[model samples]
Target: MTHPLRRGAAYAIGGAACFAAMSALVKTVGGDLPNSVVVFFRNAFALLVLLPWIAWSPGKRASFSTRRPGMHLLRATTGLAAMYCFFYALSQMQLASAVLLNYSQPLFLPFIAWAWLGERPPLRIYPAVLIGFVGVILILKPGMGWAGPAGIAGLAAGILAATSMAAIRRMSDTEPAVRIVLWFSVLGTLVSAVPAAMHWQTPSPTQWSALAGLGVIAAGGQLLLTRAYALAPAAHIGALIYTTVLFAALIGWLVWGERPDMLSGVGGLCVIAAALIVVVMRQRGSRTARA
Candidate 1:
């Protein structure tokens, strides 16, 4: 790889690792901590982390004052909902299953783009979408007791996250990354506060450290991810983002002795393959257009 591509790969893979670690931490909090409680700290502390950069960074500080407040608010609302579902899924299911389920976000992007931006997807996307859902069915195994409610939450998380992420892509056309990330933190923290307060559980000292660490880790992942995309075109490094799932599985096994059965493992591979098809095709089209 060329220097920039190599740098982008490092940033992207490292970002994915951070995300994997953050998700593992979320799972560690376990059922004792409500999703709302964790979501609140994830947002609140992320906001604290972003404030300094926005206040001081030469380029980003100016982007703080945005003209498109409504778009930012909408992304925040959708992202906040996505975060809760994902956290709930992580709490309820095997770490690998939850992460794999959420990976289906890419399957929804084509349809979202068509509706939101009038960007018609290539015909190939249709088949990829079907393949993706079949993978979901395999992973979900709806009739199985293990994949019941948690499976549903995981799917919902993927769809909701896809919506928010597509909107973020559109918004990024006009908005700065700092602005978008900052607003997500702001709205997520504010929106989740009441519910978290209502379902409050006092953490033990160790759990408190974990909760604080969650915020820092989550924010760090967001920063690295944002910078990665800024440094290189998504087409060049997008597939690398799936490293998070691999990293998560490693963490799940080492930290919690969690392992997916054969069926679930097959399903996860299917989802990853289908999502890769979509990404690879899209990147090809982008290159074609540029050429």
Candidate 2:
């Protein structure tokens, strides 16, 4: 691989690792806390971490002013909803399965973009979408016990995440990464606080530490992913993002003895392949337009 691609891959895989670890932490402590509480800490503590950096840099601090408050709120609301579903899925399902379902966000991105932005996708993407859904079906097959509430929650997370991503794309031309992340953290904390307060439960000291670490780790993952896209086109290195699934599977096996069945394993492969195809096709179309 070229140097840029290599660096992008490293950042992407590192981000994936951070996310996998964060999800593992959530699964570990999620039983003791409400999903709202978990979501609150995830956003609140992340904002805390970001606050210091903003304070340190005048330029970064100035970025707090945005003309598109509505867009930011939309992103935050959708992202927070996605987080709630994802956290609930993590608490109720096997680690790898929950992570895989969440990572399926890319599959829905094209359709979301088309509907929201009027950016129609290429015709070839239809087959890729079909393949991805086949994988979803296999992974959520009736016998797998994953077709229940938790499965629906996991799937909802992916769709909501796609919507959040589309909002991000709409703002990408005018919003820097720091500003986007900051607003999301701020709004996410405030919005989630309501439900968190309603379902409030005091956490033990150890749990507090875990929750703090969860937020910090998540911020680090976001930074790594942002840098990855900066270094290379999403198509060239986007496939590496799926490493989160592998890392999650490893954590699941080691910590919980969770091994995927043959069908689910195949399903995961299909999903990964379909997502890759979608990414590559989009990249090529963008290049053709430029040419």
| Winning candidate number (lDDT) | 2
Evaluate all candidate structures by whole-model CA lDDT and list the values in order.
0.83, 0.89
Q: What lDDT does candidate 2 reach at residue 96?
A: 87
Candidate with top TM-score is 2
> Model 2 over residues 208-240: C-alpha lDDT tens digits?
999999999998888789789989888866788
- Give a tens-digit lDDT track for model 1, residues 1-291: 878878888988988898898898888895788888898988887788777766675675336578888888888888888888888889988888899898789888888878998867789877877888888888888667558777888888888888898888787778877677777777788899999999999888888888888888888877787788877878656688999999999999998899888888888888988898888887787688889
User: Given candidate 1, what's the lDDT at residue 77?
Assistant: 82
Residue 238 accuracy (lDDT) in model 2: 75
Model 2: lDDT equals 0.89
Determine the C-alpha RMSD for candidate 1 after optimal superposition of all C-alphas.
1.7
Task: Count clashing residue pairs per candidate.
Answer: 0, 0
Worst 10 residues of 1 by lDDT: 55-64
